[model samples]
Target: MECWVPLFEIFLNSPCPETQASLWLQQSFNQPGPTTISTSSFLSLLTKPTHITITDSSSPSHTKRVMWIQTLPNAVQARVLSFLHYDCRRFCESELCQLAETMLKEGEKLDFWVKRAAHQLLDVVSRSNYEWFSSLNLDSEEEQVENEFRSLPDWLKDDVDETDLMLPWLPISQKQFNLAMQFSSCGENDDPMIEFEEGKREIVEQVIEEVDEVIKEVDEFLNPQVEELVERLKDRLLSLQSTSKAVELAGEIRELCKGGSQSLAILGKIEPWRADDEITSVLVSNLLDGNEDELGWRSHILCSVILPKLLVLKEPASRVLLTATIEYCKIHQRAAEYALLLPLILRTEGINSPICNVLTRIVTESLHQGHVSAFCQKLLSNEDDLKKFICLPCHQSLIGSKLVWTDSLFNLMQNILNHNIHLTQDSIDRLVQHAWESADRFSKSLKFGNFLLCFVTKCAPMLKSQKSLLTEATQHTNTLVTKSVLSKLSTL
Candidate 1:
């Protein structure tokens, strides 16, 4: 068997047609000495061929490999497949689908290894590529195909219980398992293997119990190490003097946090360092002073973990941190970075003078329209916030900005108008003038025309004195705007 591997590669890599080589390999698998080879060596032979195109199961080479696997003795066949299921290199979806079909056709002759291998392959293939399983057309009414199409879980019902084989392959966390269950069905009534006879209710309970036991074991094992690492992080946070050093330390802190709730619990117990004014200042300064590209990882830790925790400190400490953050946004013009701090700023500082300055700068100076749109959507959710945003000192600049004329912003403006929020007369005039300019500039645009129409209809009573503007709009060159204005002139 070991000697045959080199010869197999030589034959496969030769100039001969792949069909002839595949036929020779199939005959080689049937030879008495090679049939007695260990299961590991057999798996190596299957995977070792770099020339084997495993993706196309219908290809002659791939079909011949499938036939070779079937010709192996029952014990060797089952073991090879079972090992293949867990190997580092995975079979493609097409190959797995073919294997599943073969196992299902075995019927009464399906023994323990074959049944278990079939179940494993089906479970993996179904979860990873559900469309293939869904396309099996298992609902066919023909007697023979229907018999072979029986669900794998139903076939394995007598052989294995939930604890023996089912739990081992299930998602470890209850949340992941629940999400999988939600989308795992083939149809309304068709049972996939992920669904047990006990149904989701009981299966979920069992999963929770199993997950708790595993978590408890992990917590017991990791508690001491997490506590030690938390203390180490505290020392590094205090002693680090340079921005580059702090950035390096940030990577270690992020890794510690990835240990999940164990490290968090340990860090939570040691809250004195998180609240220290000196430490908070150092973190904020490093975050602001570090090079933008070098500080990417540290920014996430500071914003998500350090900044939020520091903001809960006393007035003097939190106020100083907020001022520094505002100045950083003003100088760097990093709109995306500033967004990470918005929720904290809104909660702790409200829409104050400093906040308004940064928001105005973002709207006018930032090139990323997506970040600008996100800031607007989040900050202007309610009527009062919307009114406050519209009344900014740079409100005119915002109106003429590129984002204000977009469809999404138009919808936002329409929402404000529908609520009947009162804007100062000057603000209303500037908004209407900007809309008219936009409509005239892009005269053929249906979207801008519709925006102008919405403003005219919704703000009709407020704009009664602006007859010249309405009359000008009536004779607009765009045919859509003219027809729409004519249709609604009586109401106006």
Candidate 2:
């Protein structure tokens, strides 16, 4: 079946190729054989450059070839279009116009593949020359074609307008068409007057005023209803005693309070002073004391809703909740679950707060490499937090831990140096020593080498002052790291 693809290509390029050959190929594709042509093989065939040279004489043959492709099964045609980088200039003006119409028709389908192909077709049309529109012959007399043009998306019409072409046949109102023509005429003249036709500007202002009124009416109708719903949910939360049932209800409230303004409004209505002390304790315990084997969803829900509501309470109450949560995480080895709340903690309490000291201690003591990696990623992603984290006293334990050679640790180190964050001498010494010890692990050699290159480049002055350590790194087991170190040494 794969052998037939090359023969089909030869037939397409053949001078005066008979239509009968295409019909024969279609029949061969349909016939049962020992090996069936797979989608991948068909994709390879479509991607090959068509060697057919275009000329006035060969235009009809080109159209025939395109039409032959259209005769393929809709599934095959859709797949080819989705993956193929179609060059629109290969098709003649008439065929290109027809292809656009076909793409518009296919765009209406609900199939994933068909929709993808239609999107690809629209991209191709957007990148091509505007001469194809001239071939459309979209005049008032051709009402069917005019209506089809009108049905095209407004974005595509805007794209055409950007070309500044005098396309009077475009499907717009007579007044708009006349206005556009006047603008074009004024642009071409040396000293031309630019003015809207009488009453047109007033009509535009009236439409704008009507639209604004509709928007205000819609907002007035929705805000009070949303506020009322939030108020009821808050009241129900205060009355609930079962932790599981309360969490279930909180999920619905979370959905309504997604945006910042909405969330603050919802939080403002919830009188945390009225929330029962026993209920808050039960929710926090359920969040922090879940089984290690349980999925992370329950913790995520509680941290997102219950934790934020608790933090909204006045000073002593909020500080007590923060202290209790951090202490529970340390004693129960719940660092992985607790990491989920870091973003909220950072936003509310900030990086300099005592909770950050607990975070550093957890990283030093955590058993799983995966959890530490996630925690580091969350910290490194925030520039201000990362700056403070690098300077923490226990940061050396993070750099010199047994899991020091992992990708996340290397990224954390690289980001610290990349930002020119001031790391104490002890931290830098520990990082270099750990790199040397881990360089012989063949699996991580490439990653180790990349980190060393970044380290040497960013900390060149510090490395030069410690010549013995720098010299030892050049003779390391990993050749990539050795080369990088030697390159830096020569420049010194």
List of clashing residue pairs for candidate 1: none
Best by TM-score: 1
Task: Give the Å error, residue 430, model 1.
Answer: 17
Q: Tens digit of lDDT per residue, candidate 1, span 256-317?
A: 64435443243333342343443455454543322332113223333434444433433333
Instruction: Let me know the TM-score candidate 1 reaches against the reference structure.
Output: 0.26
lDDT of 2 at 74: 62
TM-score of each: 0.26, 0.24
lDDT of 2 by residue, 55-122 (tens): 57645544323333455556655544432323233334344344545545644443565555555455
The Cα RMSD in angstroms, rounded to one decimal, for candidate 1 relative to the true structure is 23.6
User: Global lDDT for candidate 2?
Assistant: 0.44
- For all candidates in order, the CA lDDT equals 0.45, 0.44
lDDT for predicted candidate 1 compared with the true structure: 0.45
Model 1 stretches astray by more than 4 angstroms: 1-222, 242-248, 258-306, 309-341, 355-367, 382-492
